[model samples]
Target: MELMILLSLIGAVCSADITAFGQFMISRPIFCGPLFGYILGDIYTGLWLGLIVEMMWINAIPMGVSVPVDLTMMTILSVVWSCTAFQGCQEAAIFALALAIPFAYLYSEVDLGGRLFNTKIMHWIEKGIEQGKEYRITQGIFIGLFLFILRAGIAYFVFFIVGGIIFKQVYSFLPYEVVYGLKKAWYYLPVFGFGAVMYNFRNIKIPFLRK
Candidate 1:
């Protein structure tokens, strides 16, 4: 429970960084994954998995009205599940990544809904200002941020606990060959991710890759 709470807090921070306060890119999987891994005493697992996810979704950038999958959530939840349920198991990391993808998509909807709801809050603040309560604007910002954090924290907590259990149960029953394949995937996935990243930059003159 304590670890879950800590991870939940981290999740909120990462989610907020992606959309709320500092768009410092710390919310990126390359950073967030290792943070979770460090917290769970499995930094290498976290670092490697984070790199893979980061590469795999290298192009999931959000533009104008388009909300891509919440890759931050994917990184956080993947680390939480992989570390807690099956530390040092690449197969588990792969499984966690698979599970994390759909959850990432689900959270994208939640993220969009939250942004929509913020519009209502904006209207409320406007009404308050009409009544001479200009302070409500500041209050509204705080409230919006709090809600963002609350939503992310709760979602991660539930997914960490429930999803972690499901992963553990399912992993325990997998056949050896399948497990070996996943383990192999653990190493190769990053290579694939690197390929994806390179593919994204294929048109650019990346000095080394240019030749």
Candidate 2:
């Protein structure tokens, strides 16, 4: 219980890097996965899962008005669930990944809603500026950051608790064949990720280098 709270808080802060604050790559799955793993006492699973997610979603970048999947959430949830529920189980880790992807998409929508709300704050700040209340800009910025972290923390806490329970229950009932397949996928998914990454880089257009 205490661990969950700590992880949720850490996740919220790291998630802020996505857009709310520093654009450091700490939110990237490669970093997030291992971070959660280290906290949970299974660095190998964290490293492996992080690498797979990083490669698989290498192109999921947020640019302009396009919002990408919350990869940080995905990686954090997967690592937390897998390590807590079935530590060192590659198949279970993969299953957790399967579950985490949808949650990531769901959180993306939540993130979009948060950004939309920030637009209203933007208007409020603009209005205050016109009224000679320039301090509202700083206040609004802090408010936005608070709201963003609050939503992220709440989401991570709920999902961490709920998803951990679901993963344990569902994984225990999975058929032998399905488990076998997941184990197989545990090896193949990284290969697929590598292929996907290579494919994504195929059309790279460098300024001073040939394509």
Candidate 3:
């Protein structure tokens, strides 16, 4: 329970790093995956999961008004769920990865909603500024930050608890064939991720090299 809370807090901070606060690469799966793994005492699992996720989503960038799936949340949740529930089980980690991907997209939607709400706060700050009240700007910034962290923290906490339970229960029921396939995927997924990375790089138009 305590570990869950700590992970949720970490998730909140990392989630906020996506755009709400620091644009530091701490939000990247490569960093957070190992961090979560180390915290849960499974650095190897964390490292592999992070590397796979980072490579797989190499091109998932947030540009302009677009919101990409939250990779940090996906990676961290997978690491936390797998490590806590199944520790060092590669098959379980892969299954957790499958589960976390959709949740990442869902969180993206939730993040979009939060951004929409932020517009209201922005307008409120604008109104205050026009009326000669400068203090609203600071208040609005803090409020926005607080709300962002709160939303992420709550989401992480719920998913950690609920998702962990679901992963343990469902994984126990998986057939031997399915488990075998997942174990196979444990090796193949990294290669798949490598292919994804190469594909993304292939599409990159180097400015000086562009025709």
Candidate 4:
């Protein structure tokens, strides 16, 4: 229970950084995964997994007027589920990650909505400034952070409870071979993520690198 609560809180704080404050790159999987993994007592696999996902997603970051994929969300959910479920079984880890993609996509929708909601709050903040409400800046920032944490915390709580129960039931029915196949993918999934990230970075013409 302590581990679950501790990691869940860390997940919320790191996830908040995905858009809230200190874009010190904590939102990246390379940092987020291992960090959470460490909190849950398995930093090594978490780091490698983080590296794989980080590399694969090196191309999908948000650009002006362009919404990027929810890479951080997936990394966090995957790490949390992997750490919680099977106590570090490499094979089970792969399927947990595979299953998490849809949840990440679902989170993307809710995240977009939250940002849009923030826009309205921003407008109110602007009005408050016009009216000399000097505290609105702090108020607005607090609201943004609060909403972000609330959302992430709730999502983690829900997914952890439900995923834990359902995945256990699902895993019980799977044959050993199927489990091994997933473990094999665990070794390869990182490769896929790394390749995707590298491909995304392909356009960068480094100086004197045969441009």
Among these predictions, the greatest lDDT belongs to: 2
Q: TM-score of every model?
A: 0.93, 0.95, 0.94, 0.86
RMSD of 3: 1.9
Cα lDDT of model 1 by residue, 134-206, tens digit: 9998999999999999998988888888888888888899899988998899889988988888897676665
lDDT of 4 by residue, 159-209 (tens): 777776776778779898999788788777767776775676567877887
Best by TM-score: 2
Better of 2 and 3 by lDDT: 2
Return the candidate ranking by lDDT, descending: 2, 3, 1, 4
Each model's lDDT comes to 0.87, 0.93, 0.91, 0.76
lDDT of 4 at 46: 74
> Please, what are the lDDT tens digits per residue for candidate 3 over residues 1-211?
7878888998999988988887998999999999999999999999999999998899887889888899999999999999998999999999999998888888888888999999999999999999999999999999999999999999999989888888899999999999999999989988998898788566567799877
lDDT of 2 by residue, 1-211 (tens): 8878889999999899988899898999999899899988999999999999999889887899989889999999999999998999999999999999898889889989999999999999999999999999999999999999999999999999988899999999999999999999989999999997899768779878865
Q: Single out the weakest 10-residue window by summed lDDT for candidate 1.
A: 202-211
Each candidate: RMSD to true structure? 2.8, 1.8, 1.9, 2.4
Could you tell me the C-alpha RMSD of candidate 1 in Å? 2.8
Worst 10 residues of 4 by lDDT: 1-10
Which ranges in model 2 have alpha carbons more than 4 Å from their true place? 204-211
The candidate with the higher lDDT, 1 or 2, is: 2
